[model samples]
Target: MKRFGLAAFDDQQDDKEYEGISSAVLQRQNNELKEQLAVFQERLVGFAKKHNSEIQANPEFRSKFVRMCLSIGIDPLSLFDKDKHLFNVNDFYYEICVKVIEICRKTKDMNGGVLSFDELEKGYFRRLNVDMGDLEKSIDMLQSLDGGFEIFEIRGKKFLRSVPNELTGDQTKILEICSILGYSSISLLHANLNWKPFRSRAVLNEMVANGLLWIDEQADAEALYWDPSWINVLHE
Candidate 1:
């Protein structure tokens, strides 16, 4: 008895069937994702227009709006590149960028122009339920203004540095030392950085005024000027 060899034929048919099903599933998924993105974008664009003032004034709402933007790949600040009449989103984000800078400057006095990302987020969230990720995006936008607004991570903790002036040799040295020691008093700067006592006091005080350092006044103790920018990231 002769039997037809049909094993190869069956395997080939199964393989073709599997490929066809996979391709159809993927195409459906792609179309669905595209449709969802369009709907989300339209909703947000409408929100930006009707609630421009409220979005600018409300931290929580603004934070939510920002997250909405990032997920949709919409950048508010980019509106300046094209005709403003095209979309209200551009104007909305343009105002947001300005507000972020203003907020940074307003709060800089407490931290010497440098605030821990954790601390900043907490403060905003405490009062307004703001999102850190959104604030980070706003800070990123502020960098284009030549305002020295940048976010840095030290030991895994993020920091917001808000200052327009370039750091001097002494200033950079102080930052390097603080990255290790977590704090630098005037004496430390004088001893380690070879700064004179008067120079240390002068520079440290200047940094404090510029929002570059936090000042801790202690009775009968030399003032402790610490870098608020340093985050002692605790390792587990």
Candidate 2:
């Protein structure tokens, strides 16, 4: 007897092939959707860049941009759109940007010169709501990061180009007690630490040298004074 050709498939097998074709079609549709999303993202980035360039080219436009951002709580440095236009910023970011802008403006007013640490601290306090002490510490950290400033002496008085770092917790407590008790002597610092000071007067002397503390010229022969700036730095 003649056998049927293999091409003569069973009905059940035909149904399975039809289902496989349908699954393949669905996967193609999904891939097409993803491609469309990518194209949309690219278009958004292009729009953002166009607006940013427009703002940067005109100072009036930049000021307007800042105003518009402020109206909507957008910080120019914090969040950017698809094109990197800053938007939707929190209060902290806005404050930081404002302070930085003020500093830039002040530097311009000063004929492109650096502001003294005291001047900078006052600006920070007035513009950013940062305490004087906190301002000093932050400035110190910034100077350390950028290496642009240092403490100096002029005419037998001290001034800082930048404040030094705040003391550690233990150092802070010891220093605080010494300040309150009118003890600037190394012995006082040691006594405050239960007579087990880590580095001795050598460390205290180094702090003084670095402008972190001071030796009183008018107190008892052995009196020392924790720099008032240290209090500001630590508390701030």
Candidate 3:
């Protein structure tokens, strides 16, 4: 028993020593990574400044530069400096974010708080001299805020949701059905999804209450539930 006790103590001491060495090694590695990152950042900044004109003029080049920055855990926008005016990368996305907010507010009455990238491109993207990458980055910034901005995909189509409330699974599924023709009715849900009348109506009514679906009461057979995004597509 005495030998066992001494051996246990020795094992514990070994573990402690190993832990200390591991921590020291990890700390050194972390510091080295930080130093390397700093050097890379400095080089990137110099490169960006040198090619500022090309980045601004060439959309493809700008996108590649933004992607490279992100790959290195750097936000292209964060490179902005008021004193130096390194480049206008920050201003480009900042302006796009503002425009997105304005467009959402302007069409809130028509499309609720959800908007498709398709609709946004038609409305302002063409005039703004921006591309899909720029818009995606702008929306990414918005999503980081507490403002309930989120991007979601349904049936391979992406939609930006601006409201705080999340859509339930059933609601999202119904929207997928609506994507066929941009509208779904109780019969449609029942026939395709095999949902009972009560279940279909319950989900539809809840969606209408949440402003996700608009009711078209004048349908020939039953009330048609429409995603407002479809209306924008029709106009286009």
Candidate 4:
């Protein structure tokens, strides 16, 4: 009887100790999580202040910042029910959007509001010495407004198609192929896509009208059509 009592007492003691250990472990984990969140919020504020120029000027870095915030359960672009610190998180992006629109308006006649993303970025920054956040993110933010600003890829290149032009299935296919071939003449289109010459020409001309493709008249003088949106090798 005495031994039984001692064993029971020891078991109860072990249980009590385990409860204490569990509580401590949970508390430590909670503290660690809080510390991590604090650090993240601090980093966000730091970026908004110290790297303001870079965040606004270099779009890739701004995108990375957005990704980082998202990974930490934070969205800088969200405007409602946010902590005060995050209120202005995306203000810089909005400002960049205004400047982008101005540039688009200024160059509307040349490219039908369809400008290369690189050219758009360069043009926007060249005019004013202010920062513009990630072009993609700024574009995303702009969509919430009345402007029909968006990005599209054709012929392996990135174009900021500010107009509301939608690509048809055949047009999309042609751009995809041209993106791979760098430049496609009507003959090449008929050969690769099995398209009739007239059909190929029709599609190419339409793309030119949409400002999705450019006529490379100077390069080879062979009436070659190229999608300037296509990157060097391939863009998908």
Q: Pick the candidate with the highest TM-score.
A: 3
Candidate 1 clashing pairs, residues 3+ apart or interchain: 112-211, 112-212, 113-211
- Model 4 Cα displacement at 94 (Å)? 1.1
Candidate 2 local lDDT, 1-236, one digit each (tens) = 33367745546777799899999999999999889866855554454456766655666876676665556544343324423433332323444435644664555323222234555556455543455554445444444445444444333322343223444454445445544543456567666565544465666666566545556767665657555444344544
lDDT of 1 by residue, 1-236 (tens): 33358755567667899999999999999999999998987787776766666765677877777776877787654322233343344454455566566767787665566667676656444344336655666667767867577666655767667765656767656666676766777778778777788888877778777767777887355887777644334331
TM of each candidate vs. truth: 0.43, 0.34, 0.62, 0.48
What lDDT score belongs to each candidate, Candidate 1 first? 0.66, 0.51, 0.82, 0.68
lDDT for each residue of candidate 3 in 59-144, tens digit (9 for 90 to 100): 78877887899799875555545345555656667867977888888887776688888779776786655677778888899987
Q: Which candidate order results from sorting by TM-score in descending order?
A: 3, 4, 1, 2
Model 1, 72: alpha-carbon shift in Å? Answer: 28
Pairs that clash in candidate 4: 56-132, 155-179, 155-230, 156-229, 156-230, 156-231, 157-229, 157-230
Clash pairs, candidate 2, are 133-232, 184-224
- Point out where model 1 deviates above 4 Å: 1-99, 126-130, 152-156, 175-183, 187-202, 209-211, 214-221, 227-236
lDDT of 4: 0.68
| lDDT accuracy of residue 108 in candidate 1 | 67
lDDT of 4 by residue, 105-176 (tens): 876665556667666656456444343346667777877865587667765567665777666788767766
| Per-structure clash totals for the candidates | 3, 2, 0, 8
